[model samples]
Target chain A: MNKCHITNEIRKFRFLQSEMTQQELAEKVGVTRQTIVAIENEKYSPTLELAFKIARIFNASLEDVFTYNA
Target chain B: MYRKEKMILASLLATIAVFAVYSLYVYQHYVVPKPEIIHDFSFWGKSFLFLALVMVAAQIIVHIVFAIINKIVTKKDIPVISDEMDKIIELKSLRVSHLIFAGGTFLAIGSQAFGIQQWIMFAKLFSSGFIVTILSDITRISLYRKGL
Candidate 1:
């Protein structure tokens, strides 16, 4: 099976936003910290809703938060 | 390790221990005494019913004890809500378990067709159930560790 190559700039955005921790982002996004870690590590892809929520938390557009490469 | 991983590991251990001890007790108390009782359908039915009840009770006790000990040692609460990733992993694990169980049932039926004893068929069914459960737990732990 082909692997997903979805990547995110969540770490960069979090850093720019007062060095927000993964736990804080998780709480805001209503997910577990482990989930945020999985997303940042490219181990799991969030759903559209979760991705939008995350981008909204950083006050950024969806494209700015996540990118997918075929 | 994550609390989820710890909980799974604890459950896996409890499964093995409970199954082993229960099997030993049943063997000593019932199978060794009359041996012919193994062929009794009613005996098998009662055994399966009791085993199911014991397993459910044991799992509840194990979870409660593990949770209390974990809280005292780590001072952290276990996550109460499961996220999407957790649900996906659970579904995948259950799929594997169900597939294995189906295969086990087929093999058990095949054995009966080959003129095997009825008792062996029941044993096969029981063993398959146990194996699927253990494999499911292992699959969950592996998915958590390696990512899905």
Candidate 2:
């Protein structure tokens, strides 16, 4: 089944932000490293609050970070 | 996976394994014939209660020991923080668990309607509950591993 319709550029953003590690992002966002991995891979979609947090960390807008395909 | 989630899954799997071995032993020794079990309901009930107690006690002790050892090694207290993704994963896993449990219960009731023995019904209910709980933990662990 197609579970997630949302995709993200977390990896690219993380790289642009001085190559932030998954653990670093996770710590900053108060989540686990695994969650970042999942979000980057598009296997899981983050809530609006978490999405905003990630975008804020990278100094990017929500649209620049994530895209919803239908 | 989150550290606390991993710990919980490990503990639950270990407890289920222990219970499986113990139940096998009990079945072999105490539940040889149908009539014998009927003659001593307390034996079955007491054994189940004791095993449940053991499982709970063992889980607590194991978690405590794990925490102490982790503290000693890391020298810092690890805090588990759950975010929105964690909560969503938890809810998804819970939905799956509830469906499995409800199906098992309906099956048990159906068996009773078909004139299945009371002992079998009880066993079905008990084992289904245990197995589904383990499956739920496994689901959570896998979701954390591969994503939800």
Q: Which candidate comes out best when scored by DockQ?
A: 1
Reference-based lDDT, residue A56, model 1 = 97
TM-score of each predicted structure versus truth: 0.95, 0.81
After superposition, the stretches of candidate 1 with alpha carbons farther than 4 Å from their true spots are none
Which residue pairs collide in model 2, if any? Answer: none
lDDT of 1 by residue, B59-112 (tens): 999989988998899897777889998998899999999999999999998998
Q: List pairs with backbone clashes in candidate 1.
A: none
Tens digits of lDDT, candidate 2, A1-70: 3578898999998889899999899999888777788899888888899999999999999999999998
Worst ten in a row by lDDT for model 1 chain B: B139-148
Candidate 2's DockQ is 0.54
